[model samples]
Target: MKVAALDLGSNSFLCLIVEGDKSGIKKVLSDQVKVVRLGQGVDKTGSFHPDALKRAKECLTEFKKEIDRHNVDRILAMATSAARDAKNGSELFKIGEDIGIPIEIIPGSDEARITFAGSTEGNLKGDENVIVIDVGGGSTEFIVGNRSKLHFAKSLDVGCVRMTEKFITAQPLSESEKQAVENSVDIALDSILSEVQKYPATDVLAVAGTPSAIAAAEIGKFDAEKVHGFILDQGKLQKWCDILASTSVQEKIEKYKIESGRADVLFVGATILHRFLLKMNKPAMKVSIKGVRYGVALEVLRR
Candidate 1:
């Protein structure tokens, strides 16, 4: 079967077309992503901005063209954090229906599970203790498991876009603002820290845009193959965070090749990753190109 999987995330909209069977995926037909900032201002306003909605609709419309081109046997679309938290999130569902694709808003726990399945597939050894972290636009999902069994999963409401809107106001964030964001992250991870201690992960795998973007920056390119399995250490993360903090959004985009929409919030994302590693006591994280879209594809194929 040919399947189309769509992830309508808070910061970006992604689609993947794959040829697969009940056993496993065979080949990726197409994969695309657009940064639309669907959760813009939702942290403070409790609703998606009108422009954000419009952009999301536009991106979905474009994605539909790709899906049609592939003649997919099934289309599975899911929305995360932003849509689940926004008071006016139903608007996304309406748009999805208009586009002939009904969107399902998944809970955080489910999101963590799917993320773990996707990020670790073909990468794990079935016995190594691993934790998969997805730093999304509106939330961060933590999944702790070994190769065959999931042990712990939790989703925290501290994400790049949410943190930026909530605490960062200056173009170059002031030290005090940075400190405030750090404090907020610490508070959010308090429960996660204790729970993670119980699991004691041997390896950390990071998925989603934040980690992917950081890997791309480190390698100085946007190639998914290169980014995947890329190991980012604390020192490299700190260096990149400092660079992102000192520069303007456009500068980051132009110089570091960060996605234009992600440039502004990249610093916050880096900070979250840095703090997450510190809390987890992991020296480095391996980046995964696969994320929710890949997970959805696997689910549809099996079904």
Candidate 2:
């Protein structure tokens, strides 16, 4: 069967088409990433901006045509943090309905499970302890499990875009700002950390853009073969944070190749990643390219 998976995320909207098989699946058509910032200023307002909603609706409308062209067996579309918390979340759903694609809002635990499924396909050992973290635009999912079972799973309300809008003010932010964001990440992880210790995993699997960007940066400067699942050292991450904090937004855009829109929040994202590693006591983490989209594709295979 062919399936179309739409991920309505806080930072970006993604549509993936896949062909299901007994072994796994194959990507057929995957195109277009509309960075609509759907969760714009959601941290302060507790709701999605009206403009963000309209832009998201517009993007989904165009995606529907592509889905039809692919002639997929079914459409499995889901919304993440923003849609789950926004005051007008229902309104966004209604807009999706208007476009003929009904969106499913997934809870954090479920999100964590799906992310685990995607990450462990080739990386996890049958008996090893592993933690899979998905850093989305609006929330981050942390799951501890192995090949056979999920010991712990949770979702935190900390994400790159959310942190950017909330804690970052200046282009690169000051030293105090970096410390403030780090402290906030520690505070945010407190409740989740209490649960994480109960299931203590050995290997940490980091997912989503922030980790991916760090991996890319490492690869761009180093060797790609030595890069995948590379342990992100706290010292390196801290250095990046300090550098980002000291630089201007334009500097980040030019130096790091970060999207102009995302440059403002890159420091927060980088800081959050580093702090998470410190709290987990894991030295190195494997970066996974597969994440929610792969999970969405896997859902079709299971069906």
- Each candidate's number of clashing pairs is 0, 2
Lowest summed lDDT across 10 adjacent residues in model 1 is found at: 105-114
Off by over 4 Å in 1: none
Expressed as tens digits, the lDDT of each residue in 95-194 for candidate 1 is: 9999987788766557767778778878888587898888889988888897678889888889899989888887677889888988898888887788
TM-score of each: 0.97, 0.89
lDDT of 2 by residue, 265-288 (tens): 667777777888888776767776
lDDT of all predictions: 0.87, 0.77
Find the 10 residues in a row with the least total lDDT in model 2: 219-228
Q: Give the top-scoring candidate (TM-score).
A: 1
What ranges in model 2 sit over 4 Å off? 221-231
